[model samples]
Target: MRQVGGIIFIIILMAVMFLMDWYVYQAVKTLLPDNNLVVGKIIYWTFAAGIGLWIGFTFFTIMREGHISTRSQLSLNLFLTLFVTQLTVIIFLFGEDIFRTLNAVYQYLTSTDTGKAASLPSRRKFVSQIAISIAAIPFTGFVYGIFKGKYDFRTIRKTVYFKDLPEAFDGFTITQISDIHAGSFTDYDAVKRGAGLAAAQGSDLFVFTGDLVNHKADEIDPMMDSFAQIKAPYGQFSILGNHDYGDYTSWPSREAKQKNFQSLKEKHKKLGYELLLDESRLIEKDGQTIRLLGVENWGVGFHAKGDLEKSLRDVGQNEFKILLSHDPSHWDEQVKKHPKNIHLTLSGHTHGMQFGIETPVIRWSPAQYRYPNWAGLAEEAGKFLYVNRGFGFHAFSGRVGIWPEITVIELRKA
Candidate 1:
């Protein structure tokens, strides 16, 4: 029944997409009238048909195969890029349509001399021209995102003040990255550069919040050496994300799934990270200490393997603590109001939807609608949560405004 419903949804989506293409085609005609640019028109419709067909094929493949191949990943990226371009054109053309309709209604209502009301004005050619011209911005952006933006690694530095922070660890720096999604990477050098950037931060401790792979355990094999290069004096530690459980994919048997999971854990060790599964570790510097806790993937509407209570075991109430959780939703639902004061929580998973605008004056992403603390830092009741945009791209294979991030956090004593 579920599969049938999925097929129905796909069919409806394809219909809507094709209709959008047809509407956008009218605007294309306005710019390059049927008489002109025969080859361009052929190219436009061919590309549109290709995109629509590819999108349908990709979804069906995911539904049947439980994962997308590398080629399909590229197709998804192209489809998304074209979708953004088409949607932009639609916005302009739709606005012009609204204006035309309103003008016709207004003329009908206030006509002092109504002579069968003049036929509704034809769409001005300039409107479609402007729409096509303006749409080039996102079309170019998506193209750039596909080729360069995904590897445009940026290191974000943040300093947080804590009143009760241990004096020895006053200037403690922790470098964090999450959601590697190794299987999605196409460029080995770019991945290395990102890891190199994190290593260059030279923080006191390094932590990976979660999501080492998209599905299978072997995904990280190629990049193992690259990531293993990032090491901190306090050592590298990590926790699992929902993807690490292999829940979204099909496995031949429970035993096969368990083996993949075990291999994933082993990969973490090979990368020099201690995979913390609902566990705690104390970092001591100059006889002072801070507790670092890591929980499994805990998220609302997703996996709930994280056990906050178990991770909190044997820890003091007033002890300074930092938690590594995969999903920001966990912090909102559980970490914020825990009986013990969890001073700080680091998370990823939202990836800022891998697209959106972020500037000094305004920060926005589609990820916000789902996870309130989607990107950057959020503080409530003196507890801080910093959500890394993500260290890698997934599913879509590209990022627009939200570039991959390498976070450097300095813990300062107030």
Candidate 2:
């Protein structure tokens, strides 16, 4: 039954791709010179056929190996780039078609003969030329994203003030990173550089919100040394994210899955991160202490294994508390409205959809549609949430304007 379903899905996908190719090709032909039409068609169809073959190979590889190779992932990104470009071209061409149809309808209403009314205007070469020209923007962006933008790590520093913050801990800094989907990484040097940047922050504490690996525990083994470079004066703490549980992939048995989960936890230990599972830790300075709580993966639409109540065990009502939860949805769904006051919540998992525009004056991402606090900081009722953009790319295999983020937050007593 599953195989049949898979076959059906692939058939539908190929049909859609073919339709897009045909429509885009029509516009493309308009731009081609009459003398070189044959050459242009050969080049365009060959490129499209290569993409189709790559997709088929990827699907077969996944079925056989139960995992996607880095090469296949990169190919997938290429496919997405071309797909987006085709959509842009199609949008312009579709508009032209609509205009032509509307003009034909208007002509029909005033025509002397019904036969003449059936004729529609030919597509304008100018429109096709403009469409292809505009499509280059996204094509260039995707190429840049694949080659350079994925490794374009940036350090974002923020300051959060709270009246209830422990006075002794004022000016305390924490460096946070999240969603290191190490399996998707092809460049170890860039990964190490990002980790080195985080360590250079020299923060009082360091924390990883979640997602150390994409599917398996072994995925992170290669990048272990890079992440180990990140340390803090206080300590480094971590919690699980949805991907950390290895739930997305299939295992031979339940025990195998459990073993992988255990191995992932040990990876954290080897990296010197205290793996906090529904637990709290006390950080003391100058004879005053604040609480740091971490919970397992919990989100509105994903795994909800995190225990906020258990993590808050023994936490004081008035103590300055910081919570580490992987998904920002936790803040909206539970953390903010909880009876106990969690002064600040740190989260990731959105990755700002790995594409967006962010600037001093404006910020926008498709991720915002799904998550209100998709990236950066949001405060309500004096409680704060900061969503780290993420440390690695995932399915898209690249980052655009959002970039990969290492966040440094300074806590102040107001």
Candidate 3:
């Protein structure tokens, strides 16, 4: 909203648009037939105009109000995503054209023939055609991700064996989800169905590894009833993620941000989750107890409010502990280093960046670059961490290769 920032943003967006338009024209103008070219031009210009209008709307709105709400957030996120993917396509096609140009330059300089003119090489129609075809694959997939992939909830069942697990709790089961980012969810029925599926797992304990909302507490207010359906005898436990503190959005004042944080904590309670804020709880059976500890938001470079020492303050060193810290980076950087043995840690702040390839043969996501233990389970000498990909989408509005996830982990004593 600031004038200088707005002007800079406008300049950058204009430059990007100009380059994109040029590349798009050069890449596909010649391939379409005359009839199709007419339609394509209409489509192209309409799309370009839409982007321009969206940019104006977003900038002006933010300039006037100094911030954006859900409506503007949604529009802006969509526009940026479209811009990035289109830019990628443009870069690829431009690289192809540059190669052709260099070859043409070489041909002109090297030729020795007389009279025959050395005409600059024309773009290969076939190559342009292939470029577009290849680009369309990802474009179509991204469109589908926005429409369908985000809501396609898939439950992942995993069994982990632990030699130090208590014999009494050997067969304990936990259903874990993370990064609800409730602000971005659209369909109630679809979300409810996901919650239903998690409940249907019938685990002894249900846990959410943080990120209950995007930037504010009210995001989850409407969906309390649906989430409350998930219950376990031991109860539902949750920890805070970086986003839960309302740090990503602009607020009227520090007091407002604090109030928003309080409301988010209350939302967790209302949803039947015993929100663990740098605290510990004991899950006891007959004469045995396993410590369930949780900390506030902690990440290597993010909002690191989670206090591992405080959370484990009075707990005994020998107790079999299950710690819930939002970011896996916390586990890698801090939890694993402590002398007190933490048998298991559950986290999910990465969300796999909402895109990646995951299979038995290969598990990969851009998130892995930032957080080594970005998804699934990572193990050290005797400690383990399970990073739930995420339960909901965030800024991008939808997921792609990394669809929304529900994880069911059954624990067994080795």
Error of 3 at 273 (Å): 1.2
Per-residue lDDT, model 3, residue 301, is 84
lDDT of 3 by residue, 210-287 (tens): 999888899997788889999999899999999888877788899999999888888888899999989999998767
In the predicted model 2, the residue pairs found to clash are none
Please give the ranking of all candidate structures by TM-score, highest first, separated by commas.
Answer: 1, 2, 3
lDDT of 3 at 3: 83
Model 2: runs farther than 4 Å from truth? Answer: 60-66, 113-115, 360-362
Per-residue lDDT of 1-414 in model 1, one digit per residue for the tens?
Answer: 878887998899889888889889878887775667787788988988887887898888888887776777887887788788989999999999889998988888888885766456788899998999999999999989889999999999999999999999999999999999998997999999999999999999999999999999999999999999999999999999999999988999999999999999999999999999999999999999999999999999999989999999999998999999999999999999998999999999999999999999988888989999999999999999999999998888889999999999999999
Off by over 4 Å in 1: 37-43, 110-118
RMSD of 3: 2.9
Model 2 has an lDDT value of 0.91
Compared with the true structure, all predictions reach lDDT values of 0.92, 0.91, 0.84
Ranking by lDDT: 1, 2, 3
Local error of candidate 1 at 347, Å? 0.4
What TM-score would every model get versus the actual structure?
Answer: 0.97, 0.94, 0.89
